[model samples]
Target: YSHHLKQGGAYKCSASNIRWEVTRETHIEYKTTLWEDHLTHQQRNSWIIAGLLWEITANSEDITAIHLPHFIDYQALNDLDPPLIQIANFKDGSVSLEPASKVHPTRVVFENPKFSLLGVIICLLPCIRPIPVKGLVMVYHSQEAADVTLHVYIIPDDPAMQEAIKLKEKGSRHIMKPPVVRSMYFGHDYLLKSPCKQVEIKPKQGVEFCYVRSGQTINFYEVYSKNVNENITLWLHAMNSETCLWEAEVRPGDLSSHGDQTEADSQYDLINREHRRNLIKHINVMQPICSNLLDYNIITDEEKEAILSHPTASEKKR
Candidate 1:
């Protein structure tokens, strides 16, 4: 029995026929430029697909729930039961709270706390999905004297809020004290006690004072006696941690011993003597003479003739 011939495209053909068809057919080859364009387009499409997939995956993992804490300003501190110094949103999706009293109990409260929005933004880069913040706390410390006041600032870190605390501790460590001046005067040696603790004496000048210490009379004297007193001024000074009190005493009509004319005259005389000695020494060094020409009596002849008529034959040839 003969099998019915299946007449379709060569699907039922043998492997040889399929191979022959693949080899014989004019295989269309892609040009290099066209192939490059195609590859670029495919790559672009693949990137777009990958980007979409990544976005979808990220959205699935991203945190949609977030609890933002209330931001406190300087004015809010007065009404709040607990003074809030700083508030921070951490990287592990956690929030940290800091109290002003805990940070720096001695620090004065800020009337208007300013937030560093840019600083917060820069510091929160690591925790991008959730908002993270770094906060600053300010406290006020009244100055010992009403004229001066101190403000202490604090920053929150993993380590306890110790910036302001350290500052307060340091401030308390060194108590402010009124300045005391202790000085002695010359000629009459005595300890002079005054609100002014330090005294300045000029050259060729002296001050006298007396003080009683430990049931004994103490005399002090600061005798600034110098022959040349260019800078002489009595300075009443007070010593403090920051600065020392000072004054400049410029006494007019105080002339130096050597006048300008006398100095100029002395300098000129010395210079003239030096110049004269130099001239005499130069003349002495140039004392060597033309002994041969002099022996030939060339010096007696005047001008051109003397040089022309020399003693030696070589001189005559010249």
Candidate 2:
């Protein structure tokens, strides 16, 4: 069976006779591009998938040009050279990155000698665009979660990346948390808090959808409380509008009742978040970000000036 993303345009796997729904367990359950498992020191923090992985089955047609939906935006005809764009050919053992072309702002195209698994990977600055994409809010607490600590992640709704997170969170013992998938905007503030007085969340602050502006980076916000037994309702708050966007309940001894709780919100939360996150850092102009933040009205003037006072663009962005 041919696999497709929600857009139904970025085909995950395309083959002549084979079309199947592959899950995290298919091929490699613990691996999704699984870069970290095979990456070298030099390759570390050097690349991220353009969006999602494309897996092809056998009985496959001969390969030619494959249209991949990239995460980057090129205003001109193209911007090549530095921050190279390449086709990530997933082979039996190693994944190879071969040079490719940016045919459009949203599309990256490449060719393959024979089909295996395919995806787009870009190097260096100006990778992720500011545009919104589908996002998933995943929460978890290990069966033996020490001190009743909770781990919440706001991530893109990409299956591979989600599987990778599942792999990393093996310690959770597969305890299910109702995941909410919806549009999430970068630069906007998202806060997950517990309404119970006994439940205390740290940093006491909200996080930017793309806190680091890198798609490769993952946000794991920790929530904690001492040994208590009441079911705690955790609200995913869109702080800019002071509204509760989504919520889920976590019971101390039981997690089964909420397994069927996944749901989607309406079109707009002022702005929506992306499936993958921001990694684009190349910017000739950085002053507008301050204004952007001010327009959101989320920060105080003091906070704005402090962010602006930083010497470098990167600092200001952080």
Candidate 3:
């Protein structure tokens, strides 16, 4: 089954200046340069304008109710078989997607005025048994601009993800940590919450410690301790009950616990990090390219050198 999935074609992010492709393994691949450059000037303008409008309406907070009746029709522009991304802004400050034929309708309506829909990226891969219709919608509110929103719609990725979305639609609340989260560092502030009333993080080696106080605020009892290690556990002390809250393993430097980096891993991380920066820049500035932006190179000379200089594949695996 894995071998069959490996042969699946790529899922595309066609609207991006850089062509992004996701393999069946979920590894994202990018073309070195803009694929839309080949597009006619008028066509390219449509892409840019659509992306720009998406960046604006999605980020607006406290939107004047008067301006909510507008709907930008992007389907008329790009000639892609399946539209890259399509959005509609309704009078109620709600949004909807005009799906391709036979595809499910996607909507972004906010019940809470504090949240606003930003943008959506839909990923679909053909030939896979359980077709993974997974993508992220950029969401934000006027008050908290820095925090990330996790309202995922995993249509067919995993049964659990699909079930969670179903339960949510029925007015049930479910929360879980993301698969890839930012690493925790000494003295750095983080928003921590415990299912139980109390939660603590003690160092496996040293005297460094942190915990959740009366509120959800995380209190770092010891910062910059030299004894941070590869192994650490979060102890959730129950409050108002006898059962423990939750327990999970965590590492000091690596949030995802990717472990020691190899040459390929380092190179991939560097590129991936820059890709994320590009996405953020696009959202903030609404410019596809600017003088201050990093150069778009699929693989740099320095990176190639590092890959070549690394120990043989066998040794690196050891």
Candidate 4:
């Protein structure tokens, strides 16, 4: 997967370097690759066959909140007079990342929703058998949802569907939510809120894509240094969850010509030497970049200026 990422062509950002623009192309490539590599055909089949039930369980109590979009007729649903929604025909299904994480993948389900709408009209018009469906759903989490818009019409005789039905027959609990589009648009906030910044550009200029999250960033840098190579490093933080004290080091591909270290490093050293030593020990074993945010109470505008001044700033032209 990392290999393909290096092979994938780079998207030169002709636009201004907004947070979204800086990491847009890279996020898309990383997500598409993860869908292809991390998940298997059988796992996807299990989700389509069995996971849908997990999405629609009625008695589940974990729903924190619900918001019905204006498009949905709230009164109609409340009155049990809702408009007929097409039952999704599970012709095919695949796993797609709604959000990038090991657990996030389990919460997503994608199915074609066209057959239910068309099956009703088939008697009026002589439509071909097994019409290819559109609006492939990408992800929908059950626990976070109060009501679902889609219902599955499990095609009889399908081994996978049959298994799902048997489980249903046994009174297995399941859950459902409104179908979401397969993979959010690349510009969406899901990708833009990455904990790791787009710190550097690959100068050799082949292609690059990256997946950054709380703990690590799987960065793919395709350089013209002979053949394409994968320079992946794990990002580590001193604190769990969101904190100003987290640190990361410069990766091999992200090194700047200005210098090997940044101005923030001196500041980071002053915050806590004991913690820094322990962090460095873990970092040496992990090979992660120790970042410059260790000492700051909050990342103020002035501090942001100092941080951005590092070659790590993506807005700076390489």
Q: Which is the leading candidate under lDDT?
A: 2
TM per candidate comes to 0.14, 0.46, 0.20, 0.13
Q: Write the per-residue lDDT of candidate 4 for residues 56-159, one digit (tens) a residue.
A: 21111222211111111122223221112211222235322221111111121122111110111011022222221111111111222222211122121112
| TM-score of model 2 (CA atoms) | 0.46
**Candidate 2 backbone clash number:** 17
| Alpha-carbon RMSD to native, per candidate | 41.0, 20.3, 20.6, 25.3
- Top TM-score model: 2
Q: Cα miss at 4, model 2 (Å)? A: 19
Model 4 misplaced stretches (Cα beyond 4 Å): 1-201, 218-318
lDDT of 3 by residue, 190-234 (tens): 222323222232222222112111223222222121233443333
Taking all chains together, the TM-score of candidate 3 against the true structure is 0.20
Model 2's C-alpha root-mean-square deviation from the true structure amounts to 20.3
- Look at candidate 4 and tell me the lDDT of residue 63: 21
Full candidate order by lDDT, most accurate first: 2, 3, 1, 4
